[model samples]
Target: MERGNRESLSSSPAAAASASSQAQPQPQPQPQGLFLYHERQRLQLCLLHALNNLFQDKDAFTRADLDTIARQLQLHHPPQQKDHKWWILPLPSLVFKPHHNALTGNYDVNVLIAALEGSTHQKKVIWHDRRTPAASIDLAACHLMGIMLNTSVPRLRGFWTSRHWTALRNIRGVWYNLDSDLPAPQPFRHETHLVSFLDNTVAQGGEIFLIFNQD
Candidate 1:
C-alpha cells in the first residue's frame, strides 16, 4: 500500500483531496429490508469485506477474484520482466506482487480499481477529495453508487502500519456504514451526518472513494 502500484497516496491521509474545485455529497445507502450482507474481519481481508459491503451483495466479490487481479497486475509489470527465481525453487509470485498480501487480502487501490471497473454492471470508482466537503458535489442528483474508505492503522507493535477498508453505500435513499469490522450495518441519521462522519474519518489518515455507475 506504500507506493509499489500507485495505489496509495504518499501524502498524509489528512490531505485526501489533491484535486477538487468545490465540495460534494454521496448517495444514500441502506439495506432494503431486513437483510444486509457483511463480511467480518478475517485473515486481514478487509478490502474484500469492504467491496462486498459496498455492493450490498454477499457474493459481489471473492478472495479468488482479487487474487487473480493481483497476479495479473504483477505479470504486467515485473521488476526484471521474468519470473523471480532463487537457486532452483521458483520464488512465489506473491513476493513480487505488492498489490495484495496474497495469503490474506491486503489489496491495494489498483486491485480495487481493476476489480470494480471489471464489474459487469459497469460501475466505476473515483477518489474523493476530502479537502472539499461531500456537500460540494451534487451526489443527491442520483449519480453516486457508494463510497469505499481506506483508513491507516498501526501494525506490528505500532512500528509499521496498514490500511483498513470500509464502505458507505446508498440504497434507495438511505446511508449505511457497512464496515466489516462492525457487528452490523449502521445507518446514518441523515445525509449531513454521513458527510460529517466521512470528513472526520479522512481527517486522520484515511482516503475516500466515490463509486458511480458511469463516467
Candidate 2:
C-alpha cells in the first residue's frame, strides 16, 4: 500500500474503536430517588408559606425564633413514609406538663406512668418517676402540646382533645393521647418550651408533617 493509504488504515482502528464503544449501550444513570425538582420546589414553597405565616404573626414568633425552629425541622432527612403524609419529630420530654406546673396536688405518679405507657403517638412517652424521686408531682403525660414560654402561640387544646378522642376510639391506630384528664380537674398554669407545630409525618425518617392550628 502507498504510505498515505497505510497511514489511513492505522487511523481507522482508532475511529472504529471509538464508534464501536459509542454504539455499545451505556446504562442510563438511575435518576436520584424520589426527590424530584418539582417536589423540592413545592416543599420549599410550603416551607416559605409556613415561615410567612409565622412572620405575619411575628409578635407570636420572632424571626430568630422561627428560623431556629425551621432549622431544627429542616435538619431531619429521613425518607418519606408515604406520598401524602408529613413527618414530625416527637419530643417526649417536652410534650408533657412539667412537674412544677402541676399544682393541683393530685400527684398520682402512676397516673402519669399509665399515660406514658398508654401513649400511642409516634414519639411514645415513658414517665420515669423513680429516676427523679425528689420531684413531688402526679399526672405525667408527654408534652404532646405545649406553649413556648413568653410566646403568644395559641394552644390548640381542643385539637388535642379531638385527637385524643379519635386515638382512644381507634385501637389499631398508632397515634393517640396519653390519657383522659378528669373533669373538674385541678387548675394548672400552662408553661412549656415547645414551639409552633411543624408538619411532621411519621412515615419518613425525619420530615416535617403538616400542622393544623384552629383559630
Candidate 3:
C-alpha cells in the first residue's frame, strides 16, 4: 500500500505538469509582411486621429496651424527612422524644404490645403499656358494648389505627377485621372475624408506631403 501511494503521487505530478503545459497559451507566429502591414495600419490610424484633432473647431487653417499639427503628430508618433526629414514645396513659390524631423517622406495634402487657404498674402497670378507643358509639380504642391485655388484659375489646369501616381484634380471643373482611380466628382465629404483618402493612398505606395507652404 505504501509503495502504491508513492507511485500514485509521483504519477499525479507528471500528469499535472503535462496538463499545465497543455493549458498554457502558445504564441502564434506572424508572417513578416503581415506583421509590417498591421503595424503600418496602426500608425496610419494614429496619424488620422491626430489630424482630426487639429482640424476641430476650425474652418480654415494657416501655416501656424500646420506647425501645431506637425508638433502634435511628432508627439504622438516619434520618428522611427534615423535623421528622417519631411519636405514641403508650395509650387511656383517655395521649393522643397525640410520642415520637420520625422522619417516620413510622404506629404499630407490636407495640411497643404489648410496652409494655402489660411494665408493672407495674395499669390501672384501665374498662368500655366497650355502651349508650354505645365511644369511638373510635387505631390504637396499639386494637391495644395488644386484644393485651394478656384477651378477658373488658368494656371491650375496642368497635369500634376507624384512619385507613385499621376492625377489631375480638375480641368475647368471637370475632374479626370484622380487618385485611387476614383471616378470624376469624387465624393469628398469633409476634411477627415480627405485625410483618410490620403492615408490609404500613401499606404498603397502612393505619394503624399505634410509640409506647410510658408511662401
Best by TM-score: 1
The regions of model 1 sitting more than 4 angstroms off are: 1-33, 79-96, 155-160
In terms of lDDT, which candidate is stronger, 1 or 3? 1
Error of 3 at 39 (Å): 36
RMSD of 2: 28.1
Candidate 3 lDDT over 13-124, as tens digits, reads: 1221221123322223344221000001111122222222222211233234555655555556654544423563334122222333233322354333433344452222
lDDT per residue for candidate 1 within 14-115, as digits (tens), equals: 222211221222222434324455555665788888887787676777789889988898778655556544675545653536688766678899988888
Query: What are the lDDT figures for the candidates, one per model?
Result: 0.69, 0.21, 0.29
lDDT of 2 by residue, 68-164 (tens): 3333333453234434324544443233222211211111222222222332222233322222321232223233321100101112443432111
Query: How many clashes would you count in candidate 1?
Result: 13
